[model samples]
Target: SMETNKRNYFGISQGLIKFHPKQQYCLTAECIEAAAAVLSKINQSVDPCDNFYRFACDGWIYNNPIPEDMSNYGVYPWLRHNVDLKLKALLEKPISKRQDSEAVQKAKILYASCMNENKIEKADVKPLLSILRHSPFRWPVLESNIGPEGLWSERRFSLVQTLATLRGQYSNSVFIRLYVAADDKVSNRYILKLDQASLSLSSREDYLENTTEAKSYRDTFLQFMVDTAVLLGANASRAESDMKSVLKLEVKIAEIMIPYENRTSEVMYNKMNISELSAMIPQFDWLGYIKKVIDTKLYPELKDIGPSENVIVRVPQYFKDLFRILENERKKSPHFCLNSFRGVFPCGQQESLVSGTFISSKQFYCLLQIHSPLSLV
Candidate 1:
């Protein structure tokens, strides 16, 4: 059976490449292997002029079948699989030498913690629920008993401070995204850049399109959001109502958002001083927000950041439109819009196990984002 399996490749793979009579080169192992590799993957049955891809790749396809877990497969995937296997072996190895860095050791510990599924299952939602019970993160839809810290405080909420805390502490991005990178125009030095962020749903079409399937997707998405919130101790009626507003807000946002096709390098290069940015978009505190997000401990040299700091504002129009929408929403219902901003419901880790039944497709991917984040769902 083993020999039969090996015989599945092209006949050229079974033999070595013979040298011409006048050739002087030795038949080294590396040379032989390299020659065999090119020959092995050629499908002699197919003509190269017609369906050259199949002619070249047929042997490889027959030899290396796609894995059950993967949606697609290729040579790169096979190479990556090998690299991951090697990395896994390295990470699993115990730290024995003083030469090993602290980061390396910590990575191993994290890998071990992630691998301990029994402990994860036992601990379950307790780890994430504790995070949700705090200020700025408190979901109003949650039952007061389970969410014992009382409801979110509107009086204490500051949009700038909340944005900073969410970014600094949990590494979440909501309306605005702030990150450091080499200036797009001036390719030498790095500078902070502000841009628009993602929404809860994967596709923009789910929010934008008016088709039956699109409407169905939105309904499915909304129902999923409601179900996740209800599962997290929120009343079904309240969750459905609250989530409707949240979804409505997101749809408005989707309408205003600039599509991907328009975001060219030249179009996005709006480099200006932090003072200019504040003057332009007075709704947000530019200096204060950036200062709060930056970790002085890690970036001690960046302690000198101030109003004069030149930063790139990618989507200036979006910010203006966003605040205008928010201003209108606030005028209409003061507490309602602010409350919606803080109504964050993170999907639990073990949704199925927690409810003692499979949670199904409602357990959406991390667009509410990877963990407990301060983004709209």
Candidate 2:
């Protein structure tokens, strides 16, 4: 019986073996290169069981020292750097107007524009000043003679429209930040979410700290803002005053912001409909704001956005205080609210930026991970 069972198993194995493709040594260039890469990064002399990390990484550490600019080095960054080089090479390839796809041509055009320092310098800050001179974005710091559009009008001020337009057109979100993220409760579903956002300074600690270093950093930040406004045809005194207020407003936002430690997943998951959001915070138009920002022209399906549309309010308290501050601040300085809207004005700041820095910063853009509405990150 044992002999018969062994024979049966052998027969099955033999049948399956004949059906499988014959294995051969892969000596292709790609296979050899991949093998060489692994071989190069391993120290066979060191027993892996005794010292696994060193055995695996010693050769890699010896061969690839960290670059001067990077604070840390690893496989991920190395792969990213290689990918960027490949992308740069592809984008640098000459565009064939008739041959290339529209998307490829557009990418090539953008890459060419970024590389063109002379053309960018020639244009100067005119593009930026032109944007600021327009309705809703007319920076109050700039006087009437700044452009044909003249000074920002108090009559045209609508908090809902201004906030919405900033996000919609310029891709800048002021008080209310919108994102499309997977629901915590329903992992498979993606939902629109609103949160407090856009502070001038990166760190909330910068606003809260009373240390000398914090104070110095704040002063320098305020000075930078004032200098930027003055460079774009704003009066020095008025620029200083308005920017000081802007800085203060940012600090207030930082104060109200929920600390990272406090922002557990459960705390942030305040799911509700648009109507509930409006009822909760009656000062601002919740439905109008979301509708304005979402370009129904492009996303025609989104045109049916109504009070019943679902959304997650990440920080309800922040919105409550934010509207309260904006309401009080607007009464004092009617046109000043838009100043925060144009905080991240994309324009020529320094001569170096116009000359060589813009080209250098193209590398930064390639590395940047922006959390835009489109990205949903």
Candidate 3:
């Protein structure tokens, strides 16, 4: 058994990383892997009554099909783009080769039918049923009715509600508290300990009022664009004058948007890659976090989660300094600092404020300047 304190420690750490889209993928993947290992162990072990394997397997299925499209929606260009690539490769594989081959095949058929993407749509229910029947354990007993729904009940929580519960529980337990919301079910409360108490509807209405400020910022940014357009349009003799105006606008807008709190919290947002996030937060550990939270000690077989990389954050110099300050605060007090920016970067609200930063951009290009001393232009 893992140390008891490890559970609380990881639960909080994972909660903090959950705020960023990339980190959440990493953490969830870790859970699936741990659960898989536990399941394998139970199937091989002489003892089948072990409750640990049962819980681990059920938890895996509960959050299975991490809904890749919905998982990293509206995220920064680098992380969002990478996750899609990884998921595409994962789904492209034939079912016989998948980690949970039975379910993977079923998922492919279901998704193909619903979306009709022209990909493989054949479903094999035999392997799926075989796994279900052999498990000897049943879900719904563990609060997840995620097996073959026909064999279970159609009354299972909507995917949105189920995801919300998972997100909430994850936030409450981990270091990174992400802002996850499914359009189907928007919760009245933020799940992390920082905002355990429910916020009033009126208070949320008041917060949405930031749209006015957002619009003001948008107008200022638009002017900067107009000035750039003029700079490019101007004759060579007038180019310098227009260019200077554009530069001036750039400085002004940078000063206006991208607040201090958001800038300062870099480590929370960008430092750790998904793998590192899994290691940093103890709550998602193979032994302790799973054992305590799910009432099972056995770890699941690790799932093959993809897009193995850290989230890329383009931090301006100002935000870099802020990130250092916030990092220190996080080291000192984990729970207090994770959700400090809650009022500002709340759920479903765009946190991408500055223009230079492409934390939320889609069309990104990298300019590679390969300098060779032997080359002459």
TM-score of each: 0.68, 0.72, 0.21
Candidate 1 global CA lDDT score: 0.67
Clashes of each: 0, 0, 38
Clash pairs (backbone) in predicted model 2: none
lDDT score, candidate 2, position 269: 89
Q: lDDT of all the models against the reference?
A: 0.67, 0.73, 0.33
Q: Looking at candidate 3, what is the lDDT of residue 301? A: 30
Stronger candidate by TM-score (1 vs 3): 1
| Candidate 1 residue spans exceeding 4 A from truth | 1-99, 146-148, 333-377
lDDT of 1 by residue, 66-160 (tens): 66433246898687557656766776788856867876676567666656667867986676567666666655666443545746666765777
Better of 2 and 3 by TM-score: 2
lDDT by residue for model 2 (1-377), tens:
97677667756775675565774557899999998999799886775556879889988988999764333478987887787778777777899988898877877776677567688689887877777766767777887448657577888767777778877875677878886778889999988999878565546787789987567657767777787878777888988888889888888879999887988888998999999999999998889998898888888998999999999999999999988887888888866544443434653122112111232455435323121232531
What's the CA RMSD for each of the models? 9.7, 9.3, 26.6
lDDT minimum window of 10 residues, candidate 3: 365-374
- Which order, best to worst by lDDT? 2, 1, 3
